[model samples]
Target: MTEIRVRDLRTADPEDTAAYAAVRRAAVPALLATAASVAYSCEHAHPDARYRALVAEADGEVVGTAQVGIAQDSPEPGQGFLNIYVHPRRCGLGAGSLLARTAEEYLAHEGATALYSWVLDTPRNRAFAARRGYRASRTAHFLRLDLARGGLPPLADPPPGVELRSAADFRDDPRPLFALDAETAADEPGDVTAEFTDYAHWLTETWRHPLLDHELTTVAVVDGEPAAFTLAHTDGASRYASGMTGTARAHRGRGLAKLAKNASLHRARAAGFAEAFTGNDSENGPMVAINQWFGYETYDTEVRHVRTIA
Candidate 1:
């Protein structure tokens, strides 16, 4: 018989936390993972977020982990998210089951009426979620680009009075970027709508995130106004991730998003990053096309699952 226990993460044990992140990166390549990111998430999560980092241990060895929390920023009350990951080599030890049960119980206690999760589209993964009563909602694709080998389109000069800049340049005043993000995010396809009205929250959760690389993040400015941007995140190693790429409604059709992303990718490859990753909703045709144009090939797919607790 195997015994499993769930417990919170301890920052003091950096190696242990890194092992958890390693498993996640291997299992979900689209997700940007690093020990620093894990620690920052736990420390900087909002006071009202009710976040919990549960680790599953079997026979005194860590085998799985889960992140459970209330969607504090959502306008809809009682909405929550839980993402669980178990080591591939350690499956069948009941670690995943223990982690999922603990996470669901925590969300329920926090008054969560609906829970959302992402599971790989593989048969085993899908079956696991189905067995737990989670119904499929939508699907997204993970894409990768061989920046070190793929032929990126030639960098076109910005139009008259337009220029390319880095997010670092706006350290003194990121409000312009915030306004652009708010406008673009409103048009993004998703089951849950997001209202980017809180600038302070965005600053804390996004701009200040440990993995965010402001210097490599590319932004397109037209007439000295931010019109589009491609945010970059890195693990300070060989992996780089495209966190979000969006253009203001007014800036669409001008190729501003492509320009920003191309500039960012060139910079990343020049900086020694070997692997680049990004994801897009299956319904987001424009973005999917943009990524495909950049030589990104579909590497994996995940289905969004939802369960109503109420």
Candidate 2:
């Protein structure tokens, strides 16, 4: 077996992005990753987050990758994340461990007292994390829909006093959508709490992301205010993914989230996307049911794992 060496992503290198995205897409089938999207992430990363993407190479081939960063938006300090992925065919070649060690060292040096990782819910993956002193905390499911054939629900008619619109409609002023997104995100189930208080930061990191399709992201409006929304991401190919689906607190139980998601799914199918994917916290029952109603099936699951740097 060739020795695996880990290093930071080469700056402005398209080849590096391509190699990194390839590993990610192969390891996680439900992810919507493209070289362009990878480059955009590196280019626009916030300084506060201390984002660093590392690739593990073996005989000049990228065999694994890791994304390490601080949760800058979290109200708490010292929160960091490190999600690592190795080529499915190249597991056990030491790439994963090398990448993990490198990421852990960086995060700890950067003042992170704890590290969180998403491990695929498999016997091998769970064992690996356990050996590293990482304990499971929460579970998330990845769902996939065959847009070319999945029996997607018909676009529903908006209920009384509600209007369906796309995120593109608010390109001039997205603050309202930001507010809705922040509120919903704050309520999401997660180990690290994120507060999306920075509007300019949100626009730079999310609204303008390379994979985000403003035209396909459906937003439900009530009395000129955003009630619910479902964001869409595309790989510039026949693949699409739902970035997020959220409904304001006051609008929960009204199925506004489902309404927005349905509209987005229909539009995505019509746009020639062959497949669609999404993820939900295993604890989020309502969203899980909504996705199931739209013909989505759980293709995979990942367990959130945490380890302390004492």
Candidate 3:
């Protein structure tokens, strides 16, 4: 077997982006990723985010990839993340381990006190993480909906005080939607806490992202206020992903999130998207139920793993 070497990805190389996307798609087919999305992320990463992409090469071929970066927006400092994926056919070639080692060393050198990663729940994957000193933390499920075959709930009329609209409606001014996202994100179930305080950053990283489809995204408003929304991201092919669906704290019991998501799903299907994907923490019962209501089924599961630097 040829020796496997891990190195920083040449973000400017199209071949590198294509290879990274290939490994990721082969390793985790349920998630949405493309060469364009990969390149755009690298180009527009936040300055404080300290993001870096790495690839493992063997016999002149890229067999594995990892995304490493700090949770710069988190109120807590020294927290970092590393998600590594190796093409299934290339597993057992030491590419994954080499990539992990290289990523962790760099993050630690950047002053990270703890590192977190998402590992598939399969026995081999879990054991691989455990052997690397990472303990299991939380589990999340990747759900898939067959937009062409599965049934989506019929869109119902909004309540007397509520109305449904597309995200494009807020293009002129998205501050209200930003405010709603910030409030809902604070309550999301996760190991790391993130504070979305910079609207300019959000505008650059999210609103202007290449994959975001504002016309397909749906927002639920109550009395002229953005109460809930479902953000949609697409690959311009037949793949669609629900980036996030959230309801403001004050709008909890109104079922606005479901209303917005249902509208978004219908719009995506109508737009020729054949597959829909979304994820939810195992502990988030409400969101899980909502997805189930939309005919989404669990396609795969991954557990969050954590390791503390001594």
Candidate 4:
């Protein structure tokens, strides 16, 4: 067997992104990833984020990839992440271990005191993480809805003084959407708390992302103010993903998030998307219930794993 070696991503080569995206899509089909998103992340990563993309090669073939970065925006210091994906057919060839070790060494040198990763909730995957000194933590569920066959709840009329709009409506200026996103993200259930304080960064990293579908993203407006929204992302084909669905603190009880998501899903299906995917932390009952209402079923679950860098 050829020795597997890991190296930093070569973003200048188009095949680099394609290979990395393929490995991720095959290892975890529930998440939506594209070559453009992969390249953008590598090229536009925040300076403080200290991002690095690593690929594992064996016998001249790319067999795995890992995204390593410091959580610079986290309230806590010295936090980092390493998400490694090995091609399904290439596991056990030392690709995963090599990539993980490379990621850990790099992040530690970047001042990271702890490392976090998401591993599929399966015996083999869990064992793999355990062997690398990681312990299990919180769990999240990946839900999927077959848009072509799922019985979607019909879209309902917004209440008086409320209106529905697409994200495209904010193309002129997305500061308002950015503000709402920051607020909601701060309150989201997660092990790593993120702070979205830079508008320019958000515009470049998220608003202009290739996978983001402005026409399919739905927003709920109350009296002309943005209240809740569901951001949609697509593969520009038959797959759709709910990038995020959130309601402003002031609009929590109004079910605006649900309304926005429903509208977005409707638009996606009508536009020919056949599959819809979304994920939620197991502790988030409200979002889980809402997804269930939309006929989304739990397709897979992943457990968060943490390791301390001593």
Query: lDDT of each structure?
Result: 0.88, 0.93, 0.92, 0.91
Q: Give TM-scores for every candidate, taking all chains together and pairing residue i with residue i.
A: 0.97, 0.98, 0.98, 0.98
Model 4, span 134-159: residue lDDT tens: 99999999999999987799879999
lDDT of 1 by residue, 1-310 (tens): 7788889887558987787787788678778878878888887887777998888888878888898898786788888899898888888888888899989998999999999998889899899999999999999999999877777788888888779999999999999998988888878898776668889978988899999999999999998999999999998988889998999888799889999999999899999998899999999999999998999999899999999996
lDDT of 2 at 97: 93
Q: Which sequence of candidate numbers ranks them by lDDT, best first?
A: 2, 3, 4, 1
Model 1 scores worst on lDDT over the 10 consecutive residues at 11-20
Report the C-alpha lDDT of model 2 over 36-126, residue by residue, as the tens digit.
8898888888889999999999888999999999999999999889999999999988999999999999999999988999999999999
Number of clashes recorded per candidate: 0, 0, 0, 0
Candidate 3 achieves a global lDDT of 0.92
- Give the 10-residue window scoring lowest on summed lDDT in candidate 3: 29-38
* C-alpha RMSD (angstroms) for model 3: 0.9
Off by more than 4 A, model 1: none
Ranked by lDDT, the better of candidates 2 and 4 is: 2
Which residue pairs does candidate 2 place in steric collision?
Answer: none
lDDT of 3 at 67: 94
- Residue-level lDDT for 121 in candidate 1: 92
